[model samples]
Target: MFKTNETQMQIHSIRWLKVIDPDQEYITHISTQFSIPRNFIQTALDENASARIQCKQQATLIMTHLPFNTSSKAEQSVSCKSFAVIIKDHLVFIISKHDHPIFDQMIQYVEQGPEHSAEQLADYVYRFLELAADQFIVASKSVNEQISTVEHELLSSIKNKQVFKLLNHNKVLNRIAISLRGNSKVLNLLNDMQVVTGHQAAQHRLLNVMVETDQAQAMAEIHNINLSNLMDAYSAAIENNLSLLVQYLSVYVIIAAIPLGIASLYGMNIPLPLQEQPYALSLLAGLSLLLSVAIVIIFKKRQII
Candidate 1:
């Protein structure tokens, strides 16, 4: 899907180009229309591209990651989406692979409108970046909650399935952490842009964007460490639990073998002395029971159970 919105500000025009799941045909059309490089378009279209910032063809190309949804809720998948912010021909161009909240907000903010000049377009850019940062924070919160739930489940019974779920959380947090790190760099570039931070209001907005990006980065880092530690700690704990169970089973077998050995000897044909006794059956049964009880009592005294 693709949509275009153009707002003619007093000093410059604001052209917000939003694309979602663009195919080859759509990418080609937008590339030719905005004179945006095909490489930039292709990179944005790729699902696994790394976060980056580049300048090409007299325009600033800002490509970074955003959290995206997937089909499965249980999986809680988080993938990266790319967006480019380019200013050219007295217009601002935002090229993205998916339709995002920032895109909608910018479109409405300009259409209905706040009054600003060509230079103030930086405010729009920074605001969008701020919202993008917020997305990461939001995702981290959800991931943290899910991690807590999985940790609880692991506590009750450390199953392979639960561990896998925790592993998935680890992977997701790593991705988010990497994304935020890259974005922190890209956002720093915004601070250096005179046009983006020319006015006081624009400057403040840019600072807020930077703060949000930092907060998001911090959240990702903290949760990632937590999840990693959790998996390791629980893995060792689970092994210890298994070891205790095996020890108990070994004790049980040793105690049980005593009675079995006594019964086996009585069954042998060579046991003629016991067979000749009038109360042989009663004596053998009594002897087996007494020995089994003694073994159990000895184990108890040693606290083997």
Candidate 2:
């Protein structure tokens, strides 16, 4: 079930309030009790969320990005957006325009058992953040595998047939890079929140998340650079092959032109000095054969054949 902040609070237990708007009467009532700023509540309710931790005169404001799957592809990476304002001991408010699996799971947990403590709520938040980070690492590995496959195809056998596939891989890599960057920002915010909240355990966990994200980002960048270089190398190789083809064609043209030149001269109607000599045709044939042989030898010696 999707968790919306309109649920009523249970007796004295840590409340899981999901509100669509900070201006709602229910939200205002809680704000008064929790001493949370109306402005912070409003920002939390907005659809576009940023990673931030602000300590107002009233309560701590925590905004975090949660992962959600939007694609039908089996291996697709989930998209994420900010879910904000985890007010202290009393309320854990989250606002999101879309459904998230982890958030949904949390809601189920809450519904089945509504006895979650404040520390448990905080732990849940940290767990969700870690899950999101883990997803980033998983997505990175998928992208890396695709890159490896494409690179092998590009290097082992250069073919126009696979160009479209390579382009698609490039597009996927770009999307993964963008997601990684966003996840990195979220990790940084989590790290900062851990510091502000003095949650040493959360801080340590987030540090590991940060390290994994950085490693994934680095791998992505390297793969991208390698793909680009391979494309360039393929282009150069193709161009060199075309140049060699042209040179071979040029050599054939020169060889054929030699016989054509001899024919043209003999075709002239004017009586030439060798025309009257017996065996002149044989002599011309011998000379033409010698010239062809010489050309072949010269080309072979120059390594142009």
Judging by TM-score against the true structure, name the best candidate. 1
Residue-level lDDT tens digits of model 2 in 42-160: 66765556666777764667665544445556444435456674666556665555545555565556666534655455555555556666665665566567656655665535345
Q: Which stretches in model 1 have alpha-carbon errors above 4 Å?
A: 1-12, 71-74, 99-102, 105-113, 116-120, 156-159, 195-198, 270-297
Clashing residue pairs, candidate 2? 5-18, 5-19
CA displacement after TM-score superposition, residue 31 of candidate 2 (Å): 8.5
TM, every model? 0.80, 0.54
Give Cα-based local distance difference scores for all models.
0.74, 0.63
- What is candidate 1's lDDT per residue for 210-303, written digit by digit as tens? 8888888888988989888988998887777677788888988887787788778777878467688899888978887888788888888998
Per-residue lDDT value at 76 in model 2: 45
How far residue 164's Cα lies from its native spot in candidate 2, in Å, is 7.8
Candidate 2 regions with alpha-carbon error over 4 angstroms = 1-12, 15-50, 55-61, 64-85, 105-115, 152-203, 234-305
Q: Model 1: clashing residue pairs?
A: none
Backbone clash count for every predicted candidate, in the order shown: 0, 2
